[model samples]
Target chain A: MSGQTLYDKIWQSHLVSGDDEAALIYIDRHIIHEVTSAQAFEGIELAGRSIWRSDSILATPDHQVPTTEREKGKAGFVDKLALLQVTTLDDNCDKNNIVQFKLNDQRQGIVHVVGPEQGASLPGMTIVCGDSHSSTHGAFAALAQGIGTSEVEHVLASQCLQQQKCKNLRVLVNGCLPLGITAKDLILYIIGKLGTAGGTGYAIEYAGEAIENLSMEGRLTVCNMTIEAGARSGLIAYDQVTENYLHGRPYAPKGAMWDSAIQYWRTLVSDADAVFDKELIIDAKDILPQVTWGTKPDQVVAVTSQVPEISSAKDAVQQADWQKALSYMSLNSGTAISSLSLDQVFIGSCTNGRIEDIREVAKVVKGKKVASTIKRAMVVPGSGLVKQQAEAEGLDKIIMAAGLEWRFAGCSMCNAMNPDSLASGERCASTSNRNFEGRQGQGGRTHLVSPAMAAAAAIAGHFVDIRQVELAQLEGIH
Target chain B: MAAFVAHQGWVAPMDRSNVDTDAMMPKQYLKCIFKSGYGDWAFDDWRYLDAGDVDVDVSTRRKNPDFELNKTIYQGASILLSRENFGCGSSREHAVWGIRDMGFKVVIATSFADIFYNNCFNNGILALTLKPEQIERLFELSGDKAMSLTVNLQEKRVTLANGEFYSFELEENRRFKMLNGLDNVATTLLKKQAIQDFEKQHKQTHPYYFTPLR
Candidate 1:
């Protein structure tokens, strides 16, 4: 018999039943957030359908709630509304018996960040959320993706999900990354080359020498940006790195069951000689620390490269787009990227706001002070645990002493769901993905870069290459 | 509603790929919870340096503008032209809100990311796709003037008022929804009676008996 790819094996195993058009796939885990779940709960009430298998469903309030006000209990009715949404979810879960991590609960943060920390996100599980970046969970070697509010309602009513099988694409990144290039750079380079839509209609399996060498945190960063490239999910084949990350976690199996879990996880890798519908090969040597120059993630150039000239584009539409991007950014073509100044800097999100990202930024900003000209710079960790870890290492003090704001954990400024945002027309060097017009705030200009790059830019008050600063720290670290 | 076919004018230049929903409509205005009037705030930050404040005059902003939309090559565009894989991040319908609110009737690109494209069709926004060469030609002709691009929803054809035509593909369900302005929720609600009947029948057979888990 021919060997089956991990995608085929997991997908086939999850299939409850199927016909030609669609299949009912049993979902292993369901995560809910405030922004999309409110309406879903309303739909459930309207439909008068009680939630079945509430134990498998998990709820949290992340998107709309303010991370800063998290400590003050619930602030006012709006915050209370968000709290009420969580309460309603908890109440519904309580009435039907579903598990949730409330705001005051020990495990509370962004849904994606908290899911993994609590060991709720396991391999071979099919996870779904109402938010798009739920693809971030696929790093655990699961087939995870997002759904609409209506679909969320369906999943709540029935534990099963109706899904179409996705085509598998094996993206092979060979060779080792050059010094100073992280997984953020690798994925950014891929998105830039692929033009964002490169992975449509496919679930990408990141393989080869480079991916296997990546740490768990690094794999999460790559998987987080898969959606930015228009792929449903991106995953690495689990190995010793995966086992080590999950070994002591709360929800991971213990003792003899742990050995069995590892045995099953070891089998989660793509079978040798397994066929994939599509294949893409990228060389790690070719990638560099990247930054978004335009309104999109794919419209990026190397840190050393100049903003692309509109006149140089062969297509008139592309030329016009180039001109528009230049106009909005208030940047002229041929200007060196290093010459650009920044008003603000933000480093946090599901994308690069984990503990490792905080540590990396702290190493660069420790001895350095943020430039006086820069108006604001903040480092929001991905979760409470990440914040605690950074503080334990004195990384928070380093960030604060350098004159940057050390914020409470949440998806701050990544999306303007919270008070943290750029004033209109304010240009910022952000570690978060996407630089579309007004993404950070109305008329806010965003330049996407890695966390370390954002730290370097914050210190210089302009876009600067992190490699220019010699750091004895993070040299021998993974 | 009349299924009138409008003539396609010149194809304006395409925007960069992966323009997210948040960039289309900043989260500040999402507080309203209603979909209407969001068009004014569609690219509020990009349209003005401050929200609700347009520093440069509208005509001058349209003329001597530093804004992306006012650039000479893409002036007075009815149809927006873009590269492949447009609208990639965040499933916020605001991305479509911004696109439609900005007075763009149609968006032509090589491809569109799933959610944003669906949101566009659901809100009466047309996504016209074509080969790269054809899109390139539209941009060449649009050069710094007001050009008319006609979109015929019934025929599913995009025509430049000057007489170039292109055909694109869309799923049948999406086509029906776009033409009628029906979303999944609205469609589901249409089957309310059938759903109610099914529930009633199921309830009758199952019989309500509660046994608390110990």
Candidate 2:
């Protein structure tokens, strides 16, 4: 038999029983949030079943939690529908004996962001969540994926999930990244090349020189968008970078246990001769800051390129899709992306709302002012800890000084679960994932870009190549 | 849970490709804890000229006369004839809920996004895949007319109005679950003993992974 890929090693280790076609995989961590999980808890409760291992599950109310008016407590929710979902989750967590990070708690944040920061996600373990973005946890080399509500109920009742084994696909991004390119740009570029369905039916492992060089937070950004590429899970082999990031975190192992865990993690890599079902090689030097021109993540192009014309599409379907996307975005064909004006700027989501992302944006717009023509601009941290760390580093001050609204952490404006959404016919340069039509709000258009690029757009009142923007001199800043 | 052994409904053609869950049920509507009532807001942005709200009566709302679903011929259609990548983006089961509640029991497409397809099966909605050519043919056949199609899960076949039939495949376990109106938890319970044994061994070997309730 051939040597096994890292995905195979993790899958086999987590396999409880049955053949490769379908088996019960033990879940180490189960993360739940307000959006997709209410019905799951209700399902089990109605069936007279209880959470099998409440301790293994982490609950938080993100998605619909307002990013403003924190002092108002639960009553702070302006929408009745938002209040109901958030309160439902609270009731479920309390009744099930699961510890939850309440809205007022310091730990409360986006499920995907808080999981790793709290050390609940670790290498060689299996993780599942009701949210698709749970693939974010796979950055730690864990076997992670998103599940439907039915599967959520299954895991809550048994702490295990029945799943079919997926084929392995390895994406090796080699060479050094050029300046101004972020992991967000890299992922968007890859998804653009490999259509949204490219990673379907497979578990993709990102490897090579470029992936290895990424910081842990950058790795999280890459893995977080794996779902948009249509991958059930995306993984990076555990190494020093992974281990160092996990050390001493809240729920990470300690002392002898930590040593033992590291010892086991060392074995999590693929064997030298391991074979993948498919392998794709991407040159990092060829990549640039990317922006999605269409509703889907895969419909992306480098920031410097113009909107592609319908006649240039390879097929009839593509031509029609291009026309539709252009009509919805209200952009002219062949016009440079940099020429597109923006009405709003959003620099936060599970995709790019980590401390590093905020720091990068702050570095870009420190002494600058947001364009007077830009209607709205906001920077939301990923988690409460990230928010606090940004404040401690004075990143918030720099962002606020640039005239961008500094908001609390959540999945703000990413999918517009809160009040931070764009109005009808508005166009925005966002740091969030998924620029699907009306994703930010009804009839609102979105362009996906990096935090730095988004910040640059906020200042210019239009999309601009971040590399061309001169950083404000720190010495001149008050 | 309800069995979906066979469904016969008039077809409604959604000519667009990559009809994502967000478009099916916008993010704003996901706020409600209730699974029902999403039907009224399904495709709300495109369904109505005016912004839609739950409390507003859909009948009185300014329906988009140009939208496919509002067309006179497709008024009560139950099977959605769509293009490739139907139900892409997001793992929200609420999207499936809205589709089902909107009277669509079947979705015929060339392919489907992974999570959305699974959610369809769980919700008793048959998401059948056909070859691209066959899907194109179906779309051609659906043009300018409300065509009645039959999806028989028992036989794993989709019969066209002209007496043509195409076979589809589903996993045996999934098929069993659908036929018996069983949810995943109910089926997994049968393997409870094996799961319990595994957990016992796992907790001991990986004690740090488990955080028992205090």
Candidate 3:
């Protein structure tokens, strides 16, 4: 018999008895957010069903909460959405007895951030949420992914999810990533190499030397973008680095239980000879600071490269898409992306708004001032804890001194759920994921880049080669 | 409730492709978790300013507004006539809520993002998929001063008041639910007795395991 990969073992163990067409998998943890859960809760209420396991479910209001404090129901410019979101979640969670980390609660932030902070996320657990970014939790060696509202309703009522088994794809990245390149850049490069839907119908297992060397934060960044590549979930084999991060966390096991937990987590790695349905090997050395020049994540090029001409594109569909994207973005075919001007800059979201991401941008923008031409810049942290920590480290001061708006932690312009957004025709260099037309706001153009690259653009008033800024910053530091 | 057929009134043409969830309903208006009243905020930023003042004239807003939907051709459109692959990106239900709230009864396009299309149907929004040529005709008629189209769900046809007609398809289950405003869970519960029987039988084969409290 072949050695089972962690994906196979965990999946097989969670399978509950069900029809041949679908397996009713026992979900160990359920994460809910205000956006998708409201309707599901209503469905549950109308169907006369209560939550099956309130203790196993966790909720947080992130997407719609304002990053700045406005008096409750005061009707500030951004207060309408904020008040409605916070109150709606507050009322719903109270009625259903589902645990919620509200705005006032210290634990409140993004659902993904709160899950790990509150200890609801653990190894060998199946986590489901309405938000696609729920894949971020796979960093803990858990099987986590987003589901639709109907699936959310089913899970809330039964604590079981019906799903089909997925094939395993192993992505191996070898060699050391050069200094200044981050997991964000690596993932963007990988996604660019493999079209957005390349990993459809697969659960990805990230391996190889580069992955093994990543910190837990770096691993989380990689797993968080798995969905962008159309993978159901992305995971790194658990190791001491994983255990170290989980230790002393709110929900982590303590004392003897901790020892036992470590032992079990050791068993989560794939065996040396474990087979996979597909394997992709990436050369880390070749990856440079990356950015999205078009609407989709796959429509990317190196920061130094010009936007490719549609005529040269091999695929007819790709050519058409390139033409459409170029027209919408108001860019010429052979224009150098590095020369493009930016109207705004944002460096925050569940994808790259962690403490490490903040520190990286701070290091680059420490003494730099926002360019006079750049009208607006903001850095919203991912979580309350991240915000507090950044403040303590004076990272917030560095950002503010640079003339960027440093606000409270929330999703912010990542989706424009909050007050922060781009005006129409305004272009932004943002660290958020999707760059589709008006993803930041209607007619707002978003060029997705790494946090460091965003900081560089904010300083230069345009997309400059991050390499140039990094070299200058290093010289200053020395 | 009476059965209503989809009428093809004047189809408002939005030639822009890859319209995303945020454009459909900007996130700023997505605060209400109950999935109610969000329809008004669907394009809140594009429609009005903070003080409820019209930022741009309706024609100018549609013609040269900063929002993709405002670009001249797609203004006050009850039926969003678009190219292929509309509603791509995030699986936000706000997109559906916004479209339904905007008084758009039907979205006629060549294709839609998988999640958004499913969401549109679930939230009682009609998403009609048609061939490219048929959509082009609707776009052509949108420019006519005398052109008014109606989407009659009962007829399952989009018709111009002048008798230009186009056929669309909908699954029977979806059609029944939309006509009755029934949610999937509500539909499933109608078969509660069968579900309960299946649950009881399964319980016998798979006894629940209890973990003792420490």
What are the fnat scores of the candidates, in the order listed?
A: 0.28, 0.60, 0.24
Identify the leading candidate in terms of TM-score. Answer: 2
Residue A222, candidate 3: Cα error in Å is 1.6
Better of 2 and 3 by lDDT: 2
DockQ of each: 0.19, 0.66, 0.19
TM-score of chain A of 2: 0.98
How do these models rank on DockQ, best leading? 2, 1, 3
Across A370-469, the per-residue lDDT of candidate 1 in tens digits comes to 9998999999877778888778878888899899988776677888766688887799999887787777776688998999899999999998877777
Mind sharing the TM-score for model 1? 0.80
The digit string of per-residue lDDT tens for model 3 on A1-478 reads: 7897778766765666444234556777888877777778887888688776676677877887777762332244355555665666678788877777777666678877777765667776678888777778888788988776767887788767655577889889999888778888888888887666666667888888888888887888888888777676777888888888888876677776667667777888888888999989998898888888888877888888998888877555467778878876888988899899999999999888888888888887888899999999999888888888788877888889889998776788988856788887888999988887667876788898989999999999999877777522422223
TM-score of 3: 0.79
lDDT (Cα, 0-100) at A238 in candidate 3: 84
Least accurate 10 contiguous residues by lDDT in model 3 chain B: B205-214
DockQ for candidate 3, C-alpha atoms: 0.19
What tens-digit string does per-residue lDDT give for candidate 2 at B1-214?
Answer: 8887898989999998888889998887787777676788888888889877655677888989999998999989999989878887899988998998999989999888888988898888888888888888888988899899988889999999889999888877778778778877777778889888988897777777875523
Candidate 3's error at A39, in angstroms? Answer: 2.1
